[model samples]
Target: MGHINNKYYLGFEGEPEIIFTVVQKNNEKSEISIWSGYFNNIMQQITPVEGKWTALAYYYNLNIGWYDESPWLVDNIEDAYKQFKSIDKYKLDDLEEEILEEILELFKKSIEENNNVYISYE
Candidate 1:
């Protein structure tokens, strides 16, 4: 009934790189196609996300005000990029091109590593 009705985790080795959880919606739908469409759109840049998970925003929120030589610990090359970019940042909108690439790479790597990109509906 609604556009987005489920949660999806694009991850590798049991760790989620992209957590597309339903933050808001009008109704519920049992099908996962809706979410699949959303994922496809994000990958293709087909539509602006209204209220889905945002990888850049998450990095910003989780890294703001962090201290140390490096604010966050990174697990991979892409994550290192994200963590370094998120350092000393405050804005939520206007994601940088490099950060977007890292986010995209997260999913892409999941596929490259033979990891399932979708999690069960939430």
Candidate 2:
């Protein structure tokens, strides 16, 4: 009953996928999950973290992450491809490369800054 939102899946290699939703003010469904090993690894490396990741806007707040809808919101593989093509010129392969680069850098930065990494649904 609201505006439709695009789903963004974020993850590191060899680990399970972690989803971060790109919410449209009025839109939304889907189940969201982060791997336990991934979560624990991050916590251990970051240590005694407080604030943001403290259950505020973090993924732990499941109330905002799920619904009875498709994860990609595409009804079928064919439709998914068509919709993806309509959105941008960049191929999914290109996007994957870019996302990986950025994510790797983010992980490095978190380690360097000793700051908690907060991947929130937005």
For this target, which candidate reaches the highest TM-score against the unseen true structure? 2
Q: List the residue pairs that clash in candidate 1.
A: none
Which pairs clash in model 2? 3-27, 23-122
lDDT per residue (tens digit) for residues 1-122 in model 2: 32221222345444545442233323332233344344333323321235433222232333333222224321222322222223322422454434434434433443454433333322
Per-residue C-alpha lDDT of model 1 across residues 5-108, encoded as one tens digit per residue: 22333322244233321212232322222223333334334222375424433433343311222223222334323433444323222333334443455445
TM-score, structure 1 vs. true:
0.23
RMSD of model 1 against the true structure: 16.2
Residue range with the least summed lDDT across 10 consecutive positions in model 2: 73-82
